[model samples]
Target: MKPRLGVPSDLEAVTSAVIRTMPLDPQWDYRFPYRHQYPADHYKFTRMLFEYFLDPSFDDWLVMVAEDSLAPGDSISVVSFGVFDISYVNKRRHGPGYKPQDPVTEVENRGGKTRRDANHKHFNEFWKGQIRAYKKYFAPLGPEQMHLQILGTLPEFQRRGHASSICRWAMDHVLRKSLKDMSVMASPMGYNLYTVLGFERVGTFYIQVPGEDERLVLQAMMYKPKIWETKTTEDGDGACVML
Candidate 1:
């Protein structure tokens, strides 16, 4: 039978599995410092984000798992990503949304206005600035827009089709609802998998290793599926649609 498809109901198990595999998944190790703003024990970081960013928000996020079948202990593969509802937008300078009339956000208060529109105004403006500052390297985004938060597989389980399963599963789920385009910052190991799934390169990002001077490079990949390609198949067979 196919492995289950829900956020891992057990918080600890889910975090443990993902963290234990982090070294083998360097993007996780490299992105960790930036993701939470401070150093965190691998498992603790995964647990905190899973509980806060993913678990309770099932409607907007999907966390899928593949199990051992026999041992069936923790997941062997974990992919956690989400789609922002139409109402949501990205901002570069804003924090989370504030109440419309909060004491802080009155139009008279410029700082409050900036914070209130972080995801929308701040993000749009930020991208514009990035374009101006990095014109030689930056390229424009295409019509579709979606983001891939994370995808990882234990090294022991690599090449068993687990990675492919996770990508196809998540993409199928979004496409069935006719989600806008999807995107991800792909690690070197992940680039091939995304390409196989029809995502194309759009840009790149570089990050310095936490304690080293060397920088690691990542590709920004995006996909805009043909509207008619709304069907999902397991291992490329048996068409089904995921919600």
Candidate 2:
């Protein structure tokens, strides 16, 4: 099978595949954890933000998909990465153009209360704050700050080295230029894959997915360009050079 980078032109198909293959476990006991107790709209608000809006327009973003034309079109595995332009990020943050118009913000501002009811105010506030914190932590990046947002393989495709192939392609295509480092919030099952791919442990935290006990989340791993160097610096120092 061959793999290729997907474009926004494939958004409809990608979105459809995501909805069809995504597990319905409330705790999101899969690759990327998030709440989903209610199938209709647990994360409906933020769905457009990350899966649609952000994924579509981000120039440095990549969606590596494996496919076989003679077979079914379902993506057997995928690795999504984004190299955020820090200048654009800074402008949105510190610059006047920084519009607080993301999905959550809109929901909060329009509904006037997240829970839409007075009794649930406190719970709503707490939950909203938690999600906001996650977004804030994941948002900022220098001009070439790159991150692997999600990587996973279908159970049938495991042990096939498809993930490794995607990672290698990502290193070259997404991190090819001025990107200083690559990072990911690792899933427990993916730790070994990342370690072998040259990522080193960094930190850990607890991620609460609704209906499931809190899981230990690792912010553990960073990929430095120098470590995979096919090129050397003039000064003879080839560490993860700062961007």
Candidate 3:
């Protein structure tokens, strides 16, 4: 079966997986430094963000989850997930179901506005750095490229080859569209997996909070297809679109 489509139910599980992955990732800390100080707000906004991804009305975005067919007991079934965003969707290729547009620039204000401007100041600054990086390397995403925006597998599921399932789906998706490259901003924790999936670093970017020792750094990677023709793999239900 194909990877399950991400649904509303998967939101809680996916968010948990992401939170678990945060210790190994700085990207999360970059946007959500106040998570510890504002746990309620953190989860509230995160669910909202993923909810947007799962919304069918949102165009040119794909979010999928992988199930653990053998979770035994109460272990979560949806274990791994991937999120993708296309800069430009080809009407002729994807049909009229998608929204055709150029890459966008928007910042999510985790900062509480007037009540929490301080919480979001660094958030905005971090996003500015991210926007600058994208503008420099892959702004105005074209039909020739697709972006692997986010990929996550629970820590307990790591080394189980779950991530490859998502990567395969993405590669196949790109090849079907005949797109030339797949782009991603990979964190240190994900470098190995992306490397294994044929991604190569073309550039790097970072952001650091002024009064804190914390920093966020990522490598801009593009997938180089080893073969124009897609290859089949034993996906083992690593990722399936939610029903």
> What digit string (tens of lDDT, one per residue) describes model 2 on residues 19-117?
444343222333223234444443443343334334544443456665432247754333222222223344435665554224435455644343312
Task: Tell me, by lDDT, which candidate is best.
Answer: 3
The residue-level lDDT of candidate 3 at 203 comes to 93
Off by over 4 Å in 2: 19-37, 42-62, 69-143, 208-215, 227-243
Q: Is candidate 2 or candidate 3 better by lDDT?
A: 3
lDDT of 1 by residue, 31-90 (tens): 443433433433443465565433443333445566553246754434332222211122
Better of 2 and 3 by TM-score: 3
Error of 2 at 234 (Å): 19
C-alpha lDDT of all candidate models, in order: 0.50, 0.50, 0.70
The number of clashing residue pairs in each candidate reads 7, 2, 8
| Full candidate order by TM-score, most accurate first | 3, 1, 2
Error of 2 at 142 (Å): 4.5
Q: Write the per-residue lDDT of candidate 3 for residues 121-165, one digit (tens) a residue.
A: 566667677668877777555456778878888778777777788
In model 1, what are the clashing residue pairs, if there are any?
90-119, 91-118, 91-119, 91-123, 92-122, 92-123, 94-118
- Report the poorest 10 consecutive residues by lDDT, candidate 1: 98-107
